[model samples]
Target chain A: MKKKRALALLLTTVMGLGLLTGCGGSGSSSESADSKDAEEGKTLSMMCIGTTADAYMEGYQSIIDSFNENNEFGVTVDAEFVSNSDYKTKLTTLMASDSEPDIIFTWELGYLQTFVDGGKIVDLTPYLEEDTAWKDSFNDGMLDQLTYDGKVYGIPTQECVGTMYYNKAIFEENGVAVPTTYEEYRQVCDTLVANGVTPVALASTPDDAWLVSQYIQQLANGIGGYEYFESLKDGTGKWNDDTMVQAAKLFQEEVEAGYYEDGFTGVSGTEAEALFQSGQTAMYYNGSWETSNLDNSEYCEVSEDVSCFTMPAVDAENAYISMGSVDSSYAVSTNCKNVDAAVGLLKYWTNAENASMLLYDYGRMPSTKVELDQSKLSSLCIDVIARFEEQKSLTPWFDRVDTNIGNEFNNCGVSISNGEDPQGIYDGLQEYAQSQS
Target chain B: MKSVFGNKKSIAVFVLPAFIVYAIFCLFPIGYNIYMSFFDTNLMEKSTFVGLNNYIQLAKDATFIKSLKNNILMVIGSLIAHMPLAMFFANAIFKKIKGAAFFQTVFFLPSVICGVAVGLTWTFIYNGNYGLLNAFLGAIGLENLQQVWLSNKNLALFCIIIVVMWQFVGYHMIIQLAAMRNIDSSYYEAASIDGATGWQQFVNITLPMIKPILKIDAVLIITGSLKYFDLIAVMTGGGPNHATEVMSTYMYYQGFNILKYGYSSAIGVVLLLLCAGSVVLSNKVFKTDDTQM
Candidate 1:
């Protein structure tokens, strides 16, 4: 009896300790989350990219806090700031577990399409039709990227165009000007290299493959227009097509010419950004989403001199089209308990006041149709706005349009950079595309 | 009947909680995973049975094959390091150098540090710009040899293997050392009087005595290397076109990155089989005598 009692007590103690640890971990996570969601009657969870150290968090948190206090739903909002690279992995894991946030930060196209097709996301078409003001507030066809078979699954919060963020100070020191065409861009790179500056900063890690691919995508758009992206999607345009081959060949030649920083294949996105910001490189080719990063005094020693330009058209007849897409999007999960509160938060975020705040302070382009108060825009942002207004057309980013195709293309870019034959890279992509169908 | 009931009651009390925990955590997941592997389920959606399609497709997956090759390379590398090299260290330490205890602690320290920290430290040491390896090369007038060690596809897996070998050699060494320490000193003392050299005694007595421990070590080295995740993940992230990808990392990529849960589960089942096969093979190789002879 005594031995049995001892064993039983021992098992009980072990079980009790295990339960205590489990509760403790969850309790701490919840405690840290409490201050973010403290409203009495309503609460919504918002997920976004970047760590706490990022300045974008400050602007995003303020927007959430203001939404919580002033919204009619009286719902407080909690913002979970996942690091940019880790966010997609975490979101996919959460989605798989059916534990996705009420409103998740998502990308458009094939990314959200999986959720939409899986029926894990609520159809927002009814919500849009119910509110004319909400429906009309967005730019025409802005929501199309988030649509699948005529059903809207998300609302894009910002518009991003891949542009060449250049250091004006570097250009002035080198006695060169910003290039506006394929030939001029090449000449600019050649000149920058002669003057001892890496002409472009590009990180080629698989995660940052999108960065390299976007430049090629933009070049492809200039060479063959948006139809190339669609044709590639439909399996009609092979990755080894003349236009793609030309773009790959050009990028390779430039890389060989020392256009990018030395050992860039080994560098990460943060390191590349740092190199550009510190004036080691003459240009940083990235999306407008990085505008906030460029404008930050800490990241850039020459913040005031940092500016951007669209990659010039490779073929003048096609004109310089850009690779762009709606930025971070908001989606309501099927499991959302309060649909109205979620939509209200989305509606509130896209309102002119918040849109303007996002644009002016963070350099995030607004998806809404609201006219920007030019006086409220920074000079760096004003230039990007002008470039966006002047573009002949905009093709949604390849990755956002087709996730599988986009990832393969990005991998192809890395392979091409590593001196792999363009034909081999394209053949691999063609094989992958065939398998997808 | 009473004896059986007595045994049953004691067994029930002792095994009930463990059985319940195992069923909930392990058996349930295995069953669910097998079911899941037959479907196109994305976790949020209704699944449609695809039968053996995931496995059939995996046969043609070049990336998966590459990952399998990487896992095999890791297993071989670990076997070499953990078996012979670790045993050599164990024997040396068991003979009791002046500071054998101190050296054992020093050697085993790296294994105790979390894999993430070790990976991070090695990453810094292998960094392109300011790495210790590059600095050493430069110091020795081999500046031309300073390539980005982790980022180079050809060299990345080898670099990871070196770290794996370093981290766990000490762990296996300690295991073998403990077994060596357990052998009675009477045999060694008698062998020494009979004109046996240290190497001869080690071959005659130590090797025979530690066969069981060697079997256990072989099983551990094989399984541990096959499922190794943290160091590889924290270091290169199986990148530069999946150059250093192992089955475990590729499994994660398929399930998490691509959202192909069925395909990922198929990979998981393959890994389980590989581990089980290795254990049985090791047992066969190290089969012991039935008699005390």
Candidate 2:
């Protein structure tokens, strides 16, 4: 009886300790991911946003592998990637806790500004000034979003503009050409609908609300021009601006016209993308980032027939003010052990050799200009690149402009998709924005 | 050994470690969260102390108000489904209804399945296009009834409540069933000898006997409903413009999504208060007699 009692007590104690350990697991999540055979000072932790599921992970990994093998910093750049959906929340948690990795994949403007204001990011102006060649390599106005108080804190690796991808076979079957004006775009969609085709594939779920907002903002860009966006970015504008209202009305009209796939508000971004990739829909309006997905025959059912054009402007004068911005921008955290090595990694990633390799192998558009090799480019990529070059003005996503307000704006887009009155929704947004501040 | 288990020093030694663990993980965080609620903080910048302004702001915040209403509705829904419905099932099972074991296992099965997995299964069932529910409606010539169940703000909360009902009814049934089983065979035999009907015996004997367990169960149901998060998070993410937003999800949105940790903490404090308030109210409502079987 004594021996049995002792054994029971021992078992209970072990189980109790196990329970405590299980519950305490949250504390050890930030334990460093080790680099094989690399000593303490030789490894730098980096966090990028992608998962192995993404097609571009291959291109991203190749860049990281090359950097690890050959970078001048002699540091092994170990990267951990969270999926796109979880990236913002994870980064915010890390930022709040001050446990952010050395380098982070960041959105350009307001997203990075939150960290900059918190003094959580390293100011990269001095490094940029030291490497004039690397500084000049980036396209004009690309670094402007990352600049705050005359200090640039982040650098762009890729530029992406929203483009309307279409199925060439479906267009030809319906005898419709790529639309060049808003009227023509409407007519093309009208024709597709008349021919029993779902004109566009769009997702409006809350998780994919940005997809809807980007579309509406694209329409707003065409109608309101660059100045309207500038006004909104600066505090002279409101969410209920007449231009925004008009743009939203136009979007609703399109929704009523049966120009989008049925039950789009219930569709996820991936499901909407799949509709276009599988040739279930004629048009897909999304970022240039989707080029690689469309370029590959294995992923895209209409690979040979996929082509893109910028959605035509509502008022021709505001032609090139597009839903476009620098994507996959990298920022060094104040927590970085070695700023030099981090900046060196950033430079190596954006440099011409790797940039062109990514563009050629994957469809990532470079922030730096690289001489195009026509033989290596897919037709779809070439079309997207041409549409990208035609953009005379670009508006970064509203969420990227101000993370909190931008998020609410995305929610407003969801409201619009659900057939809510745009005027009332925008009014509510204005009230929300005021309440937040 | 001088009755070793009765020794105070040994008991304290065993409990101290667990108490410390609980204090660090639970008590400290709750205290810190309550402390943070008075400030307007992003958790990164220097936080400003606004002294109840966070709670004050929550009153005017439409989304938070909507979430609070949703939480109340969820609690009511859970009470209706888990209490009487579970009692009915438990009573039937206690009567040894045919296939009682199989039905009991089937009913208890969903609670064991993770919330995320259940949520995903229901999402597919609720999917607007090609969902099982829509297809069934169509097959029955009710095509007009087909709508995006989750995306429609009006129906979304109720739909999720139905899921909450489905997932936990069995577990609650088992709890009530256990209480029902604990009733002595003698009471029913006595009641049977007295020519009492089954319903009469249950009303006087079974109910009074299980009042204590039922009281505990009511508290569990109410508090669980108040703190519910996962299903809402997984299914719609408190969305279609947060129509289904509950307190816990709204707290997450404020803290993690927008980085308004102070406002989020205020929501957490409200949820905690609601849970505690419900527990006390439930205790009052379920006054137990010393009617042990």
Q: What is the C-alpha lDDT of each candidate?
A: 0.81, 0.88
What TM-score does candidate 2 reach?
0.95
Model 1, stretches more than 4 Å misplaced? A1-41, B1-6, B290-293
Can you give the lDDT of residue A213 in candidate 1? 77
Which candidate gets the maximum TM-score versus the true structure?
2
Residue A25 CA displacement from its true place in model 1, Å: 20
Error of 1 at B267 (Å): 0.3
State the DockQ, from 0 to 1, for candidate 1.
0.39
Clashes of 1: 0
True contacts kept of 2: 0.59
Output the number of the DockQ-best candidate: 2
Candidate number of the best lDDT: 2
C-alpha positional error of residue A200 in candidate 1 after TM-score superposition, expressed in Å: 1.5
Error of 2 at A242 (Å): 2.6
